[model samples]
Target: MEQKQPDVVDIFAVEERPGAVVFALAVCLGALVLLAQMDEQTKWLKGAALLVQPRFWPGLCLAGFAFFALCHFISTWTRHRKSRQYSFLPPDELANWARPTEYALYFMAYVFLVPQLGYLPTTLLALPALVFRLGYRSPSKLMASMLVGLCTVVVFKTLLQVRIPGGRWYEFLPDGLRNLLILYF
Candidate 1:
């Protein structure tokens, strides 16, 4: 007679990805730093109930955040300790994280231009230009982007009656057409 053992697998284990450890460490450190600054950032008023104090909830939340982040960092570190080494700051992952910042700056530029160039003209120019910048070389795609931008302006301004100011350049146009465009284009 022979006895056999069944194979067992750890269901809770996760595959580590590149840069995960660094991200976890960063989050944990950030939480700890914020938690340390809680006293300076918030006040504890005398005679105020603990529940209603301005600092109470924030302190509690930051404490919990720090605790959980520390736990995650410990777990990640332990999991990866025996595995193959990875770069502390992988360039590809850092670049991926920063990529959204470019789009955010673009949005800020668009916001600034809306006041200078009017809503319709800005939308018309921005949409196609953004499409082109995103590498849509086809004429049909560019036209579609312009159409979408135009429809959005019409819907928000004309149909919904949103309050957006006329562009600086609008005053240069003939008075009647300028007024018309300013009011509902």
Candidate 2:
């Protein structure tokens, strides 16, 4: 003789995926911020039709966004609380999200160096150095990065005629070469 087994029942079983709650919270906060700024960022024109008013459509969209985001956040919060999958915030997921900030700072440094070092020199140096930093030791890969950098400089400075200031160091070069580098390189 065998006893009967009871079935498990879960009404609020949310799919346990990493970063879902964090993403929902971020979206909710962002939408709320944008909705709060709607009055300042948009204009209310006098005697304008509702359909054509500058602020009307933007306000409607922002309100809808905020409402949906709040609903999503509440739903996720309730479901996660019931399931007990996470406590407070997920530090590992947040750290992974912030990992790209280093590259952004690197890019900012490159932008700062361009005026001091000139476009051609900065691009050439930075690309290879970045490749090396990423642990590529092969000569071919380094040379390829350098070539790509040179082509970028030529396209922007020479072909497209975009205005990038010459390096401060160009003042030490001879007149003809300095002029050539400033104008085309």
Candidate 3:
């Protein structure tokens, strides 16, 4: 007899009680600890006094996350009384997920190489690599994407006066490049 295959919904369902309980417990505990730290930093101010405090927003965010995580834990506990084995991702879909790693690595390479290659070269190289890695086979899409990315970077560096890594190469680029960098950055 052939074994029954689990449906996509079943495979991804959070029906494993132990996993849900553990995940929720971890998040709640972490949030509580974070809230305590925030309270310490904010000195537990109340009412109008709390409104003026700098730590108020961070503390509120932590408390909110803790509340939601706890609610999810409780709801999961009630709904899935019995633990069910489930696959997090089916084998068939794994290959598609794996392709993005190449793009991520290329991005990291650009980050590390930016100071050495200067912003323009690093960005120019990273953009094409990323576009190709994402399975864009058409040369037109790749060129258009690269041009758009580069133009956006140049505009920010030049027109907006945003600072980007330029290294020693900044002084040597043509006046047009410098003007573009100054205007965009």
The TM-scores, one per candidate, come to: 0.82, 0.74, 0.54
Which candidate number would show the highest lDDT if scored against the true structure?
A: 1
What does candidate 3's lDDT look like per residue over 1-185, in tens digits?
99888688876675453345555666778877887677467655456586677777877788789899889877765555553442333354456557678767877887888777667667777787777877897999889878976897767765566766564566677989866543443
- Candidate 1 regions off by >4 Å? 1-14, 172-175
Q: What lDDT is obtained when candidate 2 is compared to the true structure?
A: 0.88
Pairs in clash, predicted candidate 1? none
lDDT of 1: 0.90
**Ranking by TM-score, best first?**
1, 2, 3
Q: What does candidate 2's lDDT look like per residue over 66-119, in tens digits? A: 999999988887788888877557788788889989889989999999889888
Comparing 1 and 2 on lDDT, the stronger one: 1
lDDT of candidate 1 over 9-49, digit per residue (tens):
54554688778889999999999899989989999999989
Better of 1 and 2 by TM-score: 1
In angstroms, the error of model 1 at 143 is: 1.1
Q: How many residue pairs collide in each prediction? A: 0, 0, 15
Please report the candidate that would top TM-score against the real structure: 1
- Ordered from best to worst lDDT, the candidate numbers read 1, 2, 3
